[model samples]
Target: MAEVRTVAIVEDDPIIGASLAQRFAIEGITTQWWRSGEEALAGFARHRPQVVVCDIRLPDLDGESLFGRSTRLLGPVPFLFITAFGDIEQAVRLVRAGA
Candidate 1:
């Protein structure tokens, strides 16, 4: 079977990003952490992660926008989005729209 090569974490919160990275590492998943949407885009140009975990409230671009752009670059990869409790509605909408 083919291995799951990389998991990308796109979060502005340093703590969250580090914590998630550590957890994925423990599971033996190669991870790439991008602090912003722009950084993720640049990285995607080089290598598309097998999975992308992104924060909805990104600094440069929102999660939905990032998801759209990322899909354009690398095609439909699995994406998991995180957001604050207050933004649950938006998150739901995005998910329903296939984020």
Candidate 2:
């Protein structure tokens, strides 16, 4: 919200990813957009984003797993999970687990 330092977007959808990147750029929020779980992991470690915007279903690692790994590595940084999928169960589990 308030001038985010940096954000990592782990979204495989090209259109969504690009649109988010553009919007963040407009707000002067630096972003690193990764298309897969593997890429997101690598880039997350490298960039150390202040926040992460990730999709629930990824090509390699899936969002729940990625969120777990990211929390361990990043020390509880904020993560926002975006999903177009209709799987409400998984999302609810994550939310209840305090993800």
Candidate 3:
């Protein structure tokens, strides 16, 4: 069987983070849930997940900045941004800037 893809989630909201992690788990995808960008970056080297789902607002750093740095380190893995309803425009701008 082909290996399942691994996913990393960087979200501050506990409920959302856990729910997403659980959903991925149920689908047989490996997931690592992080509450802060700093925590996520610190362990990213070890985890090396194939996809990253990150909330735009984080305690330590914004998801855009984290995504940029992660791309530098990990060479452009897929990134999905989770933004507040009001921040959708800002998220789009970030995505256009290569975040």
Candidate 4:
């Protein structure tokens, strides 16, 4: 089994990001919490985390766009996307796009 070393948290909400990061820390997984999609992209280029926990609506770019761009850069890293505002159409689109 491969150990999960790092997780990237891309969320605009401070509390959510901090909570996730704390949990990962407890499990001995290093986490990088990025507040916006743009910042996350930069971090992804540098850190290349084993997994990503992201919020769908970011200040700069939406989660789907970020995922698309990230895939080009990092190639199929796992992303667990979350959103407070649920949109069925958007969800379906994401599913179709391999989200």
**Stretches > 4 Å off in candidate 3:** 1-4, 85-89
Question: Candidate 3 local accuracy as lDDT?
Answer: 0.85
Which 10 residues in a row give candidate 2 its minimum summed lDDT?
83-92
Error of 4 at 77 (Å): 0.8
TM-score per candidate, chains pooled = 0.89, 0.90, 0.86, 0.92
Residue 85, candidate 2: Cα error in Å is: 0.9
Q: Where does candidate 4 have its weakest 10-residue lDDT segment?
A: 90-99
Writing each residue's lDDT as its tens digit, candidate 4 over 1-99 gives 678999999999988988999999999999999999999999887889998888999999999999899989999888888988859998898778777
Model 2 earns a TM-score of: 0.90
Candidate 3 or 2, higher lDDT: 2
Q: By the TM-score metric, which is better: model 1 or model 3?
A: 1
What do the candidate models score in CA lDDT, each in turn? 0.90, 0.87, 0.85, 0.90
Sorting all predicted structures by lDDT, with the top scorer first, yields 4, 1, 2, 3
The list of candidate 1 runs beyond 4 A from truth reads 1-3, 85-88
Candidate 1 local distance difference test against the native: 0.90
Candidates ranked by TM-score, best first? Answer: 4, 2, 1, 3
RMSD of 3: 2.4
Where model 2 places Cα greater than 4 Å from the true spot, the runs are 1-3
